[model samples]
Target: MLLSGELGPGDRLPTERELSTRFWMSRNCVREAVRTLSSMGVLESRVGAGTYVTDLQPQVLLDGSSFVLELLRHRNVWEVMETRRVLDALAASKAAGRITAEQLSELRELMATMDSALDLDERIAADLAFHRLIADAGGNQVLAAVLRTVAGGTTAARKRRGLTDAHAMERMHAEHLLIYRALERGDADLAATAAAAHVAGVEAWLLDTDDSPADQ
Candidate 1:
């Protein structure tokens, strides 16, 4: 029914028994099917209310990958950044080619948060949102999924590093400007280059801050 458009996003699904009756299947089968769809982020169940269809956006569904990210601790930070660099660059390149005006407007709002917000936490939130917006707009769910996982993996490190350095924050705003400008111009190559540079700068910072005894 979902595939046949008998149900649409935000539509509340019938009770398991109702579905079983409608489809001539057992209630257990209906329950299992609902559970599976819920895991896939296609169906959402509310305890008191019942189940409904989800928006099914990739970003909304891919958060489950964060558990896998936790298991990637054995991977080097540079290795992770290397992957993000490539994925983000490609995502940005794609977004530049096809982003809509409404999406641009949203990006500009995030940029404003990064620019004028005095709270470091707010600024960082905007920073992450800006990056995610580009990837989501890229229209490639798989790339967005991988990038979100890689990014979710580093979120703790970013907050721990703090955003206290005034100069660094300024540079961050500038780097975001470069990327957003490229995106506004619909320059895929330039967007890719800027995205790569943004991630590369992050890698450089991580290397410089290496506080292990070997470096000490």
Candidate 2:
């Protein structure tokens, strides 16, 4: 699409037969790819018409990451969080250059909601949404998708551990605000540093809990 100027939002895709021949892959492989893309909201199928490229909106395509994360087992959650921290740090760096005023406003709104959330579940939801907005602003679709998946897994693990203390919540909110402020100043390096610090705090908290009396 970028190369040939033949692809754009809502453009009808070539038939499976055509794609299979073009890619020199089995028809089954093409079908599977189409199915996965459809799930990711990258492609839409109209029964009577044909499959077509979607709107390419960040939210639509990135929503599939949640489904991917939902399949992770308990033991994988820590690894997922580590991945999230790395991705989020990179996203903060990129977003410092690419983030828009509208994205910033949305992130602040989510932060406000987080401040007012009355329960663990609500706080978790707001926290996830806040990070997701940062990912979307990062200007990298693949990275945003991966962040979403890792974030989903991390949220699930936090819920399971009953780790939603007031102190933890307050700390998370403060860290998020710091990162947002850094991005507002268009400081990629500072934004990355803030993000790294935020996730590292969470990782340390998780580790501390692992060695607490309750765990024993």
User: Alpha carbon lDDT of residue 169, candidate 2?
Assistant: 66
Q: Once model 1 is optimally superposed onto the true structure by TM-score, how far is the C-alpha of residue 99 displaced, in angstroms?
A: 1.5
lDDT of candidate 1 over 72-135, digit per residue (tens): 6335666666788899999999999889899899999998887888877887788788888899
Q: Write the per-residue lDDT of candidate 2 for residues 15-104, one digit (tens) a residue.
A: 889989998999999999989888778889999999999988765766766766655535455566678788989999999998999999
TM-score per candidate: 0.71, 0.72
Model 1 stretches astray by more than 4 angstroms = 1-57, 73-75, 160-166, 212-216
Clashing residue pairs in candidate 2, if any? Answer: none
In candidate 1, which residue pairs get closer than 3 Å at backbone N, Cα or C atoms, i.e. clash?
Answer: none
Per candidate, the number of residue pairs that clash is 0, 0
TM-score of 2: 0.72
